[model samples]
Target: MQRLLHSSAPLWASLDKAMLGKLRKKTGYTFSNCKKALEVCGNDIAKAEEWLHEQAKALGWAKANKLEGRATAQGLVGVASDSSCVAMVEVNCETDFVARNKTFRSLVERVAAACLNHGKTLPQDNLTKSFLSADQLKTVPCGKEGGPLADHVALAIGSVGENLSLRRCALLQAPPRSAVHLSGYTHPAENSLGVGPVLCGRYGALVAFKATLDSAPKTQILGRQLCQHIVGMCPERIGDPEKDSPNPDTDSESVLIFQEFLLDVNQTVGNVLEEHDASILDFVRFECGEAC
Candidate 1:
């Protein structure tokens, strides 16, 4: 009787195809991982599921730590904005292929949304600009109920089989009372798959402005044009033309108002602003993989 009881133990613990498929379907983990999880949990489905999540998280962290030191110069810039605020986040990967992946784009979009949400909670004053470093962004909550941003990033790194880094994030806001209009542009602006509103590209910019009169139409057009100019011309600082005269031989493009309009080369950005009765409050430019 003792021998027979011992022999039946093996069959009782055996996991069949149906059980394996069920575990894989529920957890979206690999078949081998599911089987191993079941084996470790003594064929209990509930325990296996919990085990799978634990293992995946651990595996993700291990993979993230292993690949953290790799150089990542290729990735995408993601930007999300609304009437009141705009946010941009830069995520770096090892190759353009990964940068274009749907998962990577989704990750970037989520990060950008998180940044914008964080900014919205602050005092909705005129031109409230904030910057978040990589470490600081990791501690941010991604969604209403989601975990830390770092967990999401680590999972992405594990799934993509590469090193992933959230280099930096920036947010700009102007409430309704501030009478500031915000515009955002992304170069090679491509809509993300399975993600809404956010644009993903190699370069991006955000512009905030206010018009003298209630000329929304003119200000809107010029705001977008300014964003495009910022992305293309790469201005260093918003120089004041009144105080300092434009020098033709110097780094003239480094000044926002001094640079010629990208859409209409005949006039400077300052001239175009004057024509629309708009004045820029603040602007931000992002290039993927630029110096940290």
Candidate 2:
């Protein structure tokens, strides 16, 4: 064999910029991967790029499968909404540290936004859904390029060195022309430093209700109070959680309406609402790592 002259020299020196640029734009692959493909196929752009696509799928599957068994107990609940629409999403990771990471936090926020924009809640969807599989989440696009949400989560897994998953999602909306208004509350996030904003939370609650009043502030306060109550109680039904009530025999305070209001224990939530003529139309509550 002839002596290999300057093997350290660039293997892709003959690969022109125009050809490389085409592959990069087509596959959205990084420069290193594009160059490697060019070198692997001896600068034959077409054949090299095809192989790269095949490798990407295989790599993604392999990477995603590796973390399937890892437990995801630490995460955050993100909520995004307006008066008529609300979306709440819980994304779980392996560690609290990663849960607090900006990328991870951003992933949660984007997922919530995607949930809001995706459309109305399906009739079949109910409280306490399962973890969002990679395929399930991949359908929701996010970020500047609008890549699949699953792709962003995958990146988090790869970069954070932990298994991260979309635990569940809830979407609630009031039909057009309805008197309903939606609101959300996310308990403050706490790091080693201290507590963060209220909406940056480990747990999140969303509530929507119809208001008959012309003065909006009172209804808004009632909406927020309901959301706050949901965060504290997390009841399955307006009446649920039949275990260990303080006076189980006489009263099941577990029922949402019957439960004592957080702000003033003297008044039941139902009584407070009755006094204001405001009713709870819909509610969703999510606490990180807690199952339904």
Candidate 3:
């Protein structure tokens, strides 16, 4: 049985990569073992990877790795929200020219909205399975036919001849009985330049937050202010009192929230936060082309 399992591993692993890579990038031993297991069943990489993920999940190895590498130059950040939910997405492209294209921007907006509407209810693993324009039978001017979000993106990559990726996403959920407040801040330049042009800028930040009706308006305001502060001051952390202060524990200014807040000498986030009654549940910040 051991020899049999070992013999079938490579073929299954190859199949898994072929099938799973279509959906999203995969790595680690779980992906490899999934391929092997699938070969034992019948060279079905899809089935194998699925089964492997399930097994890995059972063994507590299914946690997703947060990829922090520098994003491709071309892309856009999109925000979509309704009363109870909010979603943010980053779609990457190869060049600033293509990133700024109206059609590309429209597509990103539509996909981001779709994710907001369907992401939570859809099967977690197949979030992008739904077709974008199933009935119209229309061809996008960019040499791609209407299809699922992932398919359209892949087509865009081929047509535009640039490496494109959906780098990050955040979805917020509110309690069923509570009214949710959603806020977003994207650098005007970041939105206009998309991913490519912003990469060339010094540094910028995008931050979003969700709070209940009981939450103070100050909290929401602070979040936006914090984002703006990040863009203008470029501090490493929220607590860092000075931008230039040396700290062995942290180096990259972008990730250090305290240091970043300190860079804006005139105003401080802590002082701003003191006035608010709300608590910040979570925040996501992204900087283009910064060292991973």
Candidate 4:
């Protein structure tokens, strides 16, 4: 019976992959989930779709066995920070509507906070083999629950009825002696979430700098401005444009020190920093739905 439905047998076969995909998207259901629904209903499109909502109500998890193939091209970046540490995470979903869900937004916030509390990423001595964000740090605990962060993610998936992914996570910290400003900014969603707190957004950024005595005020201002600049310009660094570089594998788009300044296009970020004697120690940027 199952083979007849899934296979191309004329007895049950009803549509090609294209039509199946269209139905899946229209129903906001995973491919296989939609397929099974279609099969069980004898390839009746409307009946199969009506069955999905019923299944959702009676089910606790969807796409558990098929989430990997789901396209995670929509999501928001989450940011969390404290006096000493900062964290950012890109939590992806299957659609913009899911990204706007309150539960999903809260999940992004909690995961970011988890990353911030997870402690700093390992030192640079072995930088060759490490993930930059909290998603890679397995021991980090979810802020709302006592279990590992991944568990919270799974719980969110069950409730949201979509695939959730922790694409990348990163934590940034300042040196012990100096008080660093860990600034984070989240761009508001298209529609306001209506009071409480905004946990997720279309874009997010984290920029940190070491405070110099007598230069505290200027550096702090610079940090805030840098974050704003990142949100607007999306530069690779505070340096000059690279024209002759032969290494196509190298990435400098997110390097704050190498990119041009948003405030004054004439001056590069590196030039401004040198003039002011301030240094950007570290930074991180995440835009929802960009390549991992």
Candidate 5:
């Protein structure tokens, strides 16, 4: 293979060596693949890099297809928010080690950002919810250059050598001029990317609400507390906290407002909201790798 590669780029041998190293650094492909790309493209660095990406994408899809049925119950939940919109994504892999990988963390972060960006194009006249299935999400443009999100995921799989899945994504948007307050929290928060709007962890929640008389700062504090509470409590739905009668035989914690507030166990979530003159508009909670 080495002899054949050298023979293919005979005149550029010295230059090919330099180009080979450059291609590897630029594409992050295997030595053999990079060398083959250089050989195939006659030592043209630009063409070699492009060839590497195309090949890697193809290889990634092959691997993704082969591993499709394998269980992927370990990964991260990512959340990103602006003033009026919050998006959450759950990306699953086969193990926790990969979940903690920088590449994997970045993938989740980008997915969250993609979801948030997609949310911006929707009408925000009232509290609105949107969901993207894995298939649909893969088709959306992502990254700074706006490549299909699936290409990014595939490239990641090529590098990580794991069956990674974008299990689901949820977007919550509130009217910009409305009194609604939006807040989100990522449990065991990891600022893995250090500078992106996205936060990733094992659990994440986004909550929207309205505060009639609370100060904006206080409302901000209350909103974050509500998000944390939702994450910690594992609320199934924002049931009517004020109207539902608590039954001793059933668990009320599954309902958001009925749960004891994590910030102050002395008061139920409903009580805290009532004290702040706030009412829940909607909420979303995601646990990484949880059953669909």
Candidate 6:
């Protein structure tokens, strides 16, 4: 089974063939299972993986074989937007080095863009759905020719010597005439010990505010400042003092708006917000290991 699955020797002849190596190292399942999986998936490795997972569930193989302790730590994250919406995604990889690679990062960005263009949900089916635009929505193919984002990741994985995965995605929509804004921050490279540390160290925050021409500039400024503050200060919650309590009340360190601004500790977020009457509609914060 292993030989059959990896039959195309010359095609995959290269150093750091981690995918095949991992497959070969997998125990419990016979080589026949691997071969059957590859054949069932028409030689498509990922599809074959999906098939194997299905088989594992149906046959109670994972539990019986006790192979659930495997870890999945490497991956990438992306943020994208179209005229009407914004999307965020986190795609995993086998190693942190690949997670931080420029090629991998670019792929994540493209996937996010595709999600925005298609109105597709996270863990989306039909890669072709990622290609349609609001103005030109149509059914499309599922590979490179059609520009499916998931296929792009798969091809990159095959070429880049690492196991890449699309772990999760999120899309946010705005009503007509409203706008969505996204902000992101990455740790300084000097502070990044290595890929593992960097992946674990990286953090992101995104907020969508609905506003119109009539909206106050002060309100917009407040929101932008809030985002920047989150990046700089690393607040744990939106406004729950108990969740992040050390200094509750006016002295509490957990108050979302009262905490000292990360950019300028001299001013509090609430102090800044006092100048604006805008309301916050929604906000989202993401850390590397947090829930998908």
Give the winner by lDDT. Answer: 1
- Global lDDT scores for all candidate models: 0.82, 0.69, 0.47, 0.64, 0.81, 0.49
Off by over 4 Å in 2: 1-62, 120-135, 189-198, 239-252
Q: lDDT tens string, model 6, 213-236?
A: 355564445555666666566665
Model 4 segments beyond 4 Å from truth? 1-63, 66-68, 120-139, 177-180, 189-199, 211-220, 238-260, 264-267, 271-276
Choose 5 or 6, whichever is better by TM-score.
5
What does each candidate score in C-alpha RMSD?
Answer: 6.2, 7.9, 16.4, 12.4, 3.5, 11.8
Clashing pairs in 2: 238-256
Q: What is the TM-score of each candidate against the true structure?
A: 0.83, 0.68, 0.48, 0.61, 0.85, 0.53
- List model 2 lDDT by residue over 1-292, tens digit each: 0111123456566778788899889877776677777877888888887767556645544566897788989988887766556777788888999888876786677787776666344342332222344356667766344667776676556556678887777777666556777788888733322211214478888887766766879777778778887897666666422453333532445567777788888987777877877777667788888856
Q: How do the residues 190-286 of candidate 3 rate in per-residue lDDT, one tens digit apiece?
A: 4433322112122334443333334566546665676666566565444444544445553344443333254355533554444443333444444
How far residue 86's Cα lies from its native spot in candidate 4, in Å, is 1.1
Count steric clashes of candidate 4: 18
- The candidate maximizing TM-score is 5
TM-score of 1: 0.83
Measure candidate 2: CA RMSD: 7.9
Kindly give the stretch of ten consecutive residues in candidate 5 with the minimal lDDT sum.
Answer: 1-10
What tens digits encode model 5's per-residue C-alpha lDDT throughout 1-292?
Answer: 0111223434445455777787778766667777777767877888988776777678778777877788889999999999889999998999999998998899999888988888888899888988899998888788574788888888788778888888899888988877888888898976749537889999999888989753678877888888898888787777785577544633455777777788888887878888978899888889887776
- lDDT value, residue 255 of candidate 6: 53
Number of clashing pairs per prediction, in order: 0, 1, 20, 18, 0, 7
